[model samples]
Target: MPAGVLFMFIIVFTTLVAVRMNSYVISALIIYVFFSIIGAVDDIAKVINQRKIAKGLISKQDYQYKADGISAGLRLFLYMTISLLVAMAAYKYIPNINGDINLPFISIVKRFPSLPFWLFIPFMTFTIAIFANGVNFTDGFDTLATVPSICCFVFVGIISFISSNSIWSNYLLIPHIVGLQEILPLIGAVIGTLLAYLWFNSPPSTIIMGDSGSVGLGGLIGILFIFTKAGFYLPLVGFIFFMEFASVAIQIGYFKLTGKRVFLMAPIHHHFQIMMRKSGLYKGEFQIKSKIAWRFHILSVVCLVLGLALFLKIR
Candidate 1:
């Protein structure tokens, strides 16, 4: 599981930080482990169940629970194991973080109390659940999931532009964080991985990012952004996610209050899919101009661009 690999990274990193006497990384490591195990168990159980179902002891409906989930679990398990071994090697690549690497940004971090770092754990956890659940709930058509995610990641990756450069951090008056450059590679890895995922997730998607990748990616963005001092604008950067989730939240709240449906269903994407399927919009002269998946990708990119502009402008 990618969660496991990420946990491995956090653990090794925290141990080194602990060995070096910085406790924040240790705190983060604890949170990372907790999150990773939760996801890993879910993944492991799904994979085991899928195998049983494939053996014909269980019904095919079991396999249909999350078609891509089992494969994702297997990928996550292998990747985590490999990452632990590789993370061990990175220690040799980067012996230790020094004053030079930690400079310019270190002072800015000192401005904040240590409590925020600890509190950041809950923030990250909730954000992941919301982000992942929103993505999963929104997955009704092609490009809807992956493309929006790509925009979100790219918007998040731009944080490095502010965090990586001391001059920019100073000019922007944002908290400077040394060693945040480490997140750049993480973002690159995600983008590259998504590119591979997109090959199958485009048009008629053969695979979905499922909850694993969605939650994983969302958590990665939130944590890296805050660690890099760009946490302030995450909501705006992920505006579409918030809007999509809000629709469902509003629907549920309304139904509880009035016992009436809102938007015809939860997560407006599915409502659009229903309309398209019923109207034969896929094959008719009145075929929808902006299909559900296409609109998701476009709107996500548009908002990401706007968010980036806001970031560059305000910062």
Candidate 2:
């Protein structure tokens, strides 16, 4: 089975079980499943194209599957649509949420009053799409995304549980979001699934989670933050993913304007790997071979720890 399919099954099964325990989690899971389906379809199309090429049924130059499986426009439309639906559902079901924007690191808990539905829907849709694609972009290397994801979800789960408990919310000066705690099991399920996926996806990866897994996982984290009123803290916890995404955007923008490559590669991690291989920073060949991925993973871990500590102290 494809790694994407295996991941989908595990998460879907876990979501189903979690729904039985807390039906509210189903809304978030719906967004996750939608992104996963988009990813799976794209993956399947890519596989078909690759198989055709291998069998001499299609010319490599003639293959369009890279761009044909689903157009970027269509994917963006779908992402926006699903995000709007989730936002609307939150509006209807969760009283007072009203798309409040919460800021991080003020002595007092600050919330910007709700935006109109029209503005809120599009604004939130854009935010979620950024997160989904940011994580998708970061999935380029083994364990590059998995460790950060695990850390984010674990902490988000803690935040959710705390936010749902009025006493804890009062003590921490965070909003007490009623019924948000029900999502804890769902978060737990994702964390567990990611842990299993990491076993196969670590260095010398046996299989990759692919875009499907990455986008779905990212969507889950994004929605969880929105639900828990911790959207501001997302940048803190998801700093690595945002950095990866930003590097690509910067590289592209600079190249388009100046016709010069910013880095040997984009997404930053690949740039590190390329630099390690080409720069001869290390005299030992074996050291260079091992250091690239290891260094990236170490940095990821450090960021995760920092994010966790920051959230705890702020909360």
TM-scores of the models, in the given order?
0.64, 0.88
Inter-residue clash pairs, candidate 1: 1-76, 1-77
The alpha-carbon deviation from the true structure for residue 54 of candidate 1, after best TM-score superposition, in angstroms, is: 8.7
Per-residue lDDT over 211-277 for candidate 2, one digit per residue giving the tens place of the 0 to 100 score: 7888888787888877776676777778777788789889989999999999889988778777777
lDDT of each: 0.54, 0.75
Backbone clashes counted, model 1:
2
The digit string of per-residue lDDT tens for model 1 on 207-259 reads 65444445444444544444544455666666666667788889988999999
Q: Return the top candidate by TM-score.
A: 2
Error of 1 at 287 (Å): 7.0
Error of 2 at 210 (Å): 1.6
Whole-model lDDT for model 1 versus the true structure? Answer: 0.54
Candidate 2: which pairs clash?
none
